[model samples]
Target: MKVVIAPDSFKGSITATDAATAIAEGWASVDPAAEIVRRPMADGGEGTVDAFAAAVADAKRMPITVDGPAGASVRTSWLLLPPTEDAPAGTAVIDLASTSGIELMDRLRPWEADTTGFGQAIAAALEHGVSRLVLGIGSSASTDGGTGLLRALGARFLDDGGAPVAAGARGVLAIASVDMSGLRPPPETFVLTDVTNPLTGPRGTAAVFGPQKGLTEPSDIESVDDALLRLADLLGLDAQHPGTGAAGGVGGALVAWGARLTPGAQEVAELLDLAATIEGADVVVTGEGSYDGQSGDGKVPSFVAGLAASAGARAALVAGRITADADIGLFAGVASLTEIAGSAEAALAEPARHLRQAGAALARSLSD
Candidate 1:
């Protein structure tokens, strides 16, 4: 029998790699002869770089320092994959959360935060001569329509005086024109995200994501949303394009700079060659920190289940917390920390141990 253990990071607890290890150990305890495969997964968020580092042989980490979301400095690293036939010079992988994510902020600077740090990292990667770029643009801290990122790449966001505007959403409101004459793009670029929102409108960036970044007031949301519309107009971006509203409109901005937007989970699945690994598996197990209704929308668990079903293998999902309406029908079996640990607090406090327990339980039930 063969079992593949692939899971995403349990946020605020264990990483994807550790989760996979713990599960595999438990599975081994039950079926020592079963072939086990461990694959850690991420959907273009915080753990993106680590995912590639673990899966790709000869991958290196390139360290750099850049501005943080709230005007501070942050030390982070991007991943460099060794040369391939498609990208002979190599490929650079960057996660926006490492440099410009809301997690880096002490307090939300909703309007003042920007994507400058993300842009700086990208610039550094370009300077290193990478032939292609893979950018994970999730967990952003601002809704500046990506003006700050464009600025770092030499695209000017000018005020009425033809001078550079301030960075962040405030800059978005002050922009008189946009200049892309000095912008530099790599041979190929992929912007990884799961969002499909428009650039600006009732369902756009500010309206949907601003509150999470501290822009809760109706006035604030309206102001930023309008500014994003202005930014789009000046950039000649289609506000209604799918994914244009991702990362506070960074998706649209990257599109303007010649980058393609891809569904993060599907993109990562291809990179990991998940389907090929599931072809002969008896059962495929996957997991995440939380399993909710939204998990069905391009999240790791749903993607894994789809691949397992295609390969004629039963799929089991294990998560830290599995909500009541999480579309449990997608998996043949489901295990959650809340049920195994008796409480959410206990589960979070000792996630690895509980994850192991869940794995053993799944193995026993599936083997029956």
Candidate 2:
């Protein structure tokens, strides 16, 4: 049987490529004669760079210094794909999550974190003369409504007192006017995002995601909401644009800067040529750290499964934890589903073993 393995990162347990490899290995052990193709996938979130780099040739890593989530100096990395003779000379892929990801901050200091480093990274990429920038916006820690990132790129946020506020969620509320004099124009920019939340309101940035960023109680919620409103008014932005709440309002800011916002999985899948990869496979396996209702909303695993079904291939999921009520049927040709372990701790403690087990179960089901 021709089998394709394409899985997202197992969160803290494994990389997407490694997850694919483990699944492939398990399938190989079960059916030694199986023809297996491995394609790692990401949702343009945390592992976007690694997934794209592994799939496409000529993508290289470039290291640069940027601010950490806590306003400290941190050395982070971004991907640099040197242009071919036929392509433009200055095109780069950037994952904003790499610099401002929630995972990058200390849990105790989430309130103090910001996205300044992400903006700095963008500036650095621009300095390299990159004409086209593809930025993945996910896993953010800041709820400053993207003001922090804008500030880093030379946009200044001044209070009514004409004093500069700090760069965090708390700082967003004090904005009286924005000074864009220091901003440099980029040729073109695209922001790949996985969410559709608006900038402000019940379904807005702070309400939907602030709690996850270490925000506690109704007061913290009110604080972030107020801050976002202030920033929106100061920047003359519509507070209700779809996807404006993405990455804590970074989506709206990018839109203000004329960046195109597309589904994260769709953009990454097209970039990786995922549809073409699935065409020849008899069965395809795709998954993530967790699979739930959110997976149906333009996530990587669902994207891969959709492609597999379109190509007349059976798809399966191998996730670390599968929520009981998740609609697995959305993955139309997904013939099998397997959770890595019964719990998170077990999965993390022995990811390789659990992956092999999941793979074996899938192999048996497919062969049956």
Candidate 3:
């Protein structure tokens, strides 16, 4: 029997690479002779670079330091995929969640967090002369509408007095003019995300995602929304385009820079050549930190399940937590680390252990 293990990072606990390895180990324990292929995956978020590093033999990490969401220096690296037929110079994969993401902040800098680091990393990759860019724009820390990133790329957000404004949402609100003469031109950029929100309305960046970044009062959300609208106007771009509201308006900002917004899971799958591996597998195992209603909506697990179905493979799932809203019927086998560990706390305490058990459980289902 052949089995392919591909899972996303169990956020705050285990990485996708480790999770895939652990699951493979457990599956091997049950079926010692089964062929196992571990292909760790990410949907343009926290583990995106790791995913590429694990999938491609020639992929390299180019390290660089940049400003974090809270204005601190952050050491991070972008993945550089070796030159391909389609991309002669190579491709750079940069994920926002690891650089200027919310996790980098000690506390929510709702009004002050920015994407400067993300932009800096991208700038470094550009300097390296990468021909194409795959940007994961999830888990942003601020709603600055990508101003911090733009600033790092040489686009100036000036005040009425012609001086640069402060960074973050605060700076976005005070913007009185724009300068793009010094901005760098991005080449064939693709922004990966599942979001389809507009930039500045009820379903826009501030209105929907601001509270998560600490915006509470209606007035606060309204103010940020207005600021984003103003920024869009200045950029002469449509604010209501789908996905413009992603990553606290980073999506919209990238759109202003000529980025093509694409679904994260699908894009990553193609880059990893995931479907080809599942083509003849007997069982395909996939996972994520949480399997809930949202998981079915273009998440790694759901997308993997679809591929498994197409290949006539039995899809199995092992999740950190499988919520009641998730449809377990989508998979031939399902295991929850929370249930196996007897508690959510215990599951997170030793995720690798539970992931192993989850793998064993799915392996048992194969014979039954």
- RMSD in order of candidates: 1.4, 2.3, 1.0
Judging by lDDT against the true structure, name the best candidate.
3
lDDT values for all models: 0.89, 0.80, 0.92
Model 1 agreement with the true structure over 78-184: per-residue lDDT tens digits = 99999989999999999998989988888988879999999999999999999999999988998889887888898998999999888888888889888889998
Better of 2 and 3 by TM-score: 3
Colliding pairs, model 1: none
Candidate 3 lDDT score at position 232: 95
Q: What TM-score, computed on C-alpha atoms, does each candidate reach?
A: 0.96, 0.93, 0.98
The sequence of per-residue lDDT tens digits that candidate 3 reaches over residues 1-368 is 99999999998898899999999988888988899999999888888889889999889999899899999999889999999888899999999988999889899989889999999999999999999999998788899999999989999999999999999999988999999999999999988998989998999989999999998899999999998998999998899999999999999889999899999999999999999988889999999999999899999999999999999999999998999888988798999999999999999999999899888888877944
Worst 10 residues of 1 by lDDT: 8-17
Which residue pairs clash within candidate 2? none
Q: How many clashes would you count in candidate 1?
A: 0
TM-score ranking, best first: 3, 1, 2
- Stretches of candidate 3 exceeding 4 Å from the true structure: none
Off by more than 4 A, model 1: none
Clashing pairs in 3: none
